[model samples]
Target chain A: MSQATLNRLADAGFSGWTTVTGRTLAAYQAAVVRIGVALTFGGFLLREWPHRRVLYGDLSPWSGDLARQMLASNHAFTVLAWSDGRWWFEGVYAAAIAVSVLMLLGWRTRATSLLFMVLVLSLQNRAVLVGDGGDNVIHLMAIYLAFTRCGQVWSLDARAARRGTRRTGDPVGVVVWAALGLALAYCQLSGFASLGMLDFGLYSWGTFFWLCWLLAGLRGLLARRAPEGEGLALLDALATLVHNAAMLVIAAEVCFIYATAGWYKIQGSLWQGGTALWYPLHLHYFEPWPGLADGLSGSSTLVTAITYGTVIAQVGFPFLVFNRRIKNVMLTLMIAEHLGIAIVLGLPFFSLAMITADAVFLPTGFLARLGQGVARGVARIAATPVVRQTIMRAPRTPERDPEAVSVIR
Target chain B: MADEPDEATSPEPIPPLAETPDLPDEERRWSLPSLLVLYLTAVAVAVAVVYHLGTVFLSIAPANPVSQRHATAINAHVLPEFEQNWQLFAPNPLQQNIAVQARVQTVDSTGHRLDSPWIDLTARDVAAIRGNPLPSHVNQNQLRRAWDYYTAWHDQQTEKSTGFGGPLSEEYLKRIGLQRIGRDWEGMAVIQIQFRSATTDVTGPSWTGAPATTSPSYRQLPWWPANDDDYRGLGVS
Candidate 1:
C-alpha cells in the first residue's frame, strides 16, 4: 500500500483503538469489583467465630497423604514449607482463610487482601494435589483484587471517617488490569493444553467445556461496557461478535466433552447396565461408602438410569445450561453426579472443587445479593467509631488538595 | 492569559515551578516505583499460582500406579502359569545353535569325585532340572523368557551336530555341568554344547521357469558358539 493510504488507514484505526482501550479499562474496573467481592466473601468464609474448621478439616487422610507426597516430590521448589509436624501449612492455611474472610468483610480490606494473596499462593505452592481449577481461578483473581481499588466502595476502608482525605488515584487499578490480562492469557494456554490431550479425548472435552465457561463468564462481564458510536459503534459491534464467537468456541468444547464421554461410556458394555457403578465401590482406594455400593448394585434399574442419565446430562450440559430452567436441573444433576462420585469413588476433594466451579454458573444476581448481605452484616459490626477511626488514620497521601480528587476518579 | 506577562521574562525569575506547588502538599501522582512494586508482586503471585496448579493437574493421572500393584498380585497368584506358557518362536531362527554339556566331578560335602548319574532333561525343563521354581529377580519378563529360550537353542545344537567331539573336548565337557555359561556369564550347573547347522541346496520342480532337480544336498561348516567358552571348560573348584 502507498504511504498516503497507510496513513489514512492508521488514522482510522487510532480512533477505534482508543475506544477499545476505554472499553477495556472499564472492563478492568468491573473485573476488580467482581474479584473484590469474591475475595471478601472467600475470606469471611475462612474465619470462624467459634474457631471451627470446615473445608480443610474435611479432607481425608488419603488426600493429605497425596499432598505430602506432592510436597516431597517438588522439594526443590519449596513452594510448600511444612515444618513442626503440620504447623506451618496449617497456620498458613488458617491465616489465609482468615484474611480472605477479613477481605470479604472489607475491614482492613487492602491489608487483608494482600495477606490473603500471599498466604493462598504459599498454600497452593506447597501442595499440588490439593487444588483444582477453581483454586487456580480464585488465586489469580485474589492477586488482582489485592492491588486494585477493590476496597474503594462497600468496604470498611472506604466508609471510614476520613474518607475524602485519602488520594483516590492509585496504580493498584493498573495492577489489577495487568492481572486480568494475565488471566486471559492463562485461560487461552489452558484451553490449548486441553486440546493437546488427544488420547484422553473425553477428558479433553471436560477441560474444553471448562474453558468455554470461563470465556463465557468473561464475555458476559465485558459485554456490559461495550462502546457506543457510528463507526466506533461498528468496532464495538465487531468486539461483541468476537465475544460471541469465543462463547461459541467454548460451547463447542463443552459439547465435545460430553459427547465424547457419553460415547466412550456407552461403547463399553459394562457401563450400559449399571454393573460398572459397583466397580468404584469395590476398589479399596476409592470406596468411601462400602455397603452403599452393594445397595446400588442390587437395583440394576436405578444404576442403569443413573448411567444413562449421566451420559445424557454430560452431553446436554452445554445446551441445557443456556436455558434457565434446564440450567437449574443440569446444575442439580451435576451436583448429584459429583456427590455420587465422592461417596462411591472417594474423590471428595476433586468433587468439591468441581462443584465450586459449577457454582459460577449460578445466577450472578444471586451471588451479588449474597455479597450485599454479607457487606451489610460487616458494615453493622464495623460501624463503631473506634474501628472507623483506626481505618481512617491508617494512611494518607501527601496531597491534601481537594481539587485534584476529581482529576482521576 | 497572554496579557499576564511570561513569568520568567517579566520579573525576578518567578520562583522555580517545583517550589511554587505548596511544598509537600502538592498533588502526588502515582510514582514509577510504586507501580513497579505492585506489578512485580502481581507477576510473582501469578507465577506461583501457575506453578502450583500446573504441577497438581499434570500429576493426577499416572500410567503405572494400578498396573504395578496388579502385576505383583497376579504374579503371586499364578506362578506356574508363566512357566507352562514358554515358547521358542522367532521369525528367523539362529543358524549356529550352541549347547554346553558338563560333568561336575565333586563329592556332595565328603570331597569325593561327584559321579552322579547323567540325568536326562529336556531343554524346556531346565528350570525344573535346576530345582529353582521361581524366575530371576529382574523385573523384565524378557529375562525370564531368555532362560527357556537359550536352552532350546542349545538342544537344537545337540540334535543337529552328529560329531560333537571337535568342540566338546573333555576339558570343555567338565566345565559344562558345574560353572557359568551364556553371554551374560550366568553361573549355573549345566552341560554346554555348540554347533552350526549345515547349509542345504534346494532342487525342486520348475514351476516358475527354473530347472527341476532330483534331490536336495547339505554341506558342513565350522561352528561359532554364542558363549565365550564351552560349558565343559569350567570346573567347580
Candidate 2:
C-alpha cells in the first residue's frame, strides 16, 4: 500500500471514532454490573457454606487425608499436599469462606475480593483430584472481579456517607474499560479450555454463555457514551464493535457445544432409554437414594422421556435463546435439571455453581433492583459512627488515595 | 513567523463538551508497578492457603482398620501362593493351570494361628485365604457376592457345553463343601486357585523356497510336571 493510502485509511479510522449512536452502550454497562454483582454474591455464598459436606457427605474428610499422602510422597506436584486433611487446611478453608462472605456483604469489599480469590484458588490448585470445571471457572472469575472495580456501584463501601459522592474521572473509565477486556478474555479462555482442548462437549451451551458475558462486558466499557447521539468517541465505537464480536463468538461456541454433544449422545443406546442417567445415580459415591434404583426399574417410559428431554435440551439450547420467552423457559428448565442432578446425583456444589452462571440469563432490571435494595441496606448500616470509625482505623498505606476510594463510590 | 494570522483570526481550540471529564493528575491510573504487586500478592496468598490445607489431609489413616489390615495381610500371603502355582512365561506362551489347597487357621488373642473347632468353611478365592466374609464388612460382602456370581456362571457355562465332564463329581463336591452352613465360618480362611493362559504368536518373513506361502504352526501343551523346587523357590513351601 502507498503511504498516501495508508494515511487516508488512518484518517478515516480516526474520524470514525467521533460518531456516537444508540442506547446500546448503557445497556451493556447495566448488564455487566448486574451480572458481576450476582456472580459475586453466588460465589461468596458457595465459599462460605460448608460446601464439602453438602456435596461429598462424610467422605469429604477423605480430601484432606489424600492431601497428606501426596505430601509424604514428596512428588514434584507437592502442592497437592496443601489439601491434606488437616486442621490447618480446614482453617484456611474456613478463612477463605469467611472472606468470600465478607465480600458479598460489601464490608471491605476490595480486600475481601482479593482474599477470597487467593484462598479459593489456593484450595483449588492444591487438589486436582477433587476439582471439577465449575471450581476452576469460579476461581478465575473471582480473580478477574478482584482486579475490576466490581464493588463500585453495588457495594456497602460505595454507600458510606462519609466516603462522599462517587468521583468521576478518566482513570475510572479506563479501569472499567480494562476490566471489560479482561472479562472477555477470561470467558473466551475458559471456553477454549473446556470446548477446544478438554472437549467437554458442553460447547453449545458454553458458546451462548460466552456471548452473554462478552455483551455484558462491552456494555460496561461503553457506558459513558451518550445513547442515541452523534459524535461518538473512538473508545465507544471500539467498545461497540468488541461487544458485537463477543455476541457472535458466544453464538458460535454454543452451537458447537450442542451439535457435538448431541451427536456423541446419539451414538449411545443407553441415552435413548435414559439408562445413562441411572449410571450416575447408581454410583455408590454419588447416589442419594440407592433404593430408588430398584423402584425405578419398571419406569421405562419416564426414563425414555428424561433421556429424550436431556438430548433435546442440550442440542436446542442455543437456538432457543434467540426468542426471549423460549430463552426464559429453557433457562428455567436448565436450572431445574441442574437442581435434580445435584440432589439425586449428589453433585450439589457443582450444581449450585452452574446455576449461578446461568443467572446471567436473568433480566438486568431485576438484578439492578436487587442491587438497589442491597445498597440501601448498606447505607443504613454505614450511618453508625462506630462503623465509620472502625473502617477508618483499618491499616492503609498512604498510596491508597482517599480520592481513588471515592471514585468507586 | 512574520506572516502569521492575527491572534483573534487564529481562533481558540474547541473545548471538549462538559461531561464526566478526566482527572487532572495522570497518576490516578493504576500504575503498572502497583498492579504487578497486587497480582503477586494474590498468587502468594493463594499458594500459602493451599500449602496449609494439604498437610492436614494427609495424616489420617484409612477408616476401617480391621478390614484394611486383613487386606494387607492377604496380599502378603497370596503373593507367595500366586508365585508357587503360576508359571512365569514358558513353553512358548505359558498356559498352565494349577489347583491350590489349604486349611484355615484362625489367630486367637494369644497370638497363635490355630484351627478353630467352632468354624466350618468352604474354599473361596486366593484373597479370602487370610479371612472369611464378615457380615459387617461392605467390601468383604461385595467380594463374596462376586465370587458367588462367578461360580454360578462358570457352572452354568460348563453344564451347557457338550464336551465338559458331567456336573462336578460327587467326590469333588465332598472335598469342597456346598453352601456355607453357619456363622462359625466368619473368621476362618479358605483356599482357592485361578487358571490363566498367556499366548504369543510370532511370525517371520516367508522363506524363499518352493512354497513361499507355507506358514509355521505351533501350540504349547497345558500340562506340565509339578516341581517341588519351583514351589520352594516361590517361598511358599
Q: Pick the candidate with the highest DockQ.
A: 2
Model 1 TM-score on chain A = 0.45
lDDT of 2 by residue, A204-269 (tens): 323533443454334433333442222123223333333333333323333343444454565566
Best by TM-score: 2
Model 1 misplacement above 4 A = A1-78, A81-91, A103-121, A129-269, A339-349, A365-409, B1-237
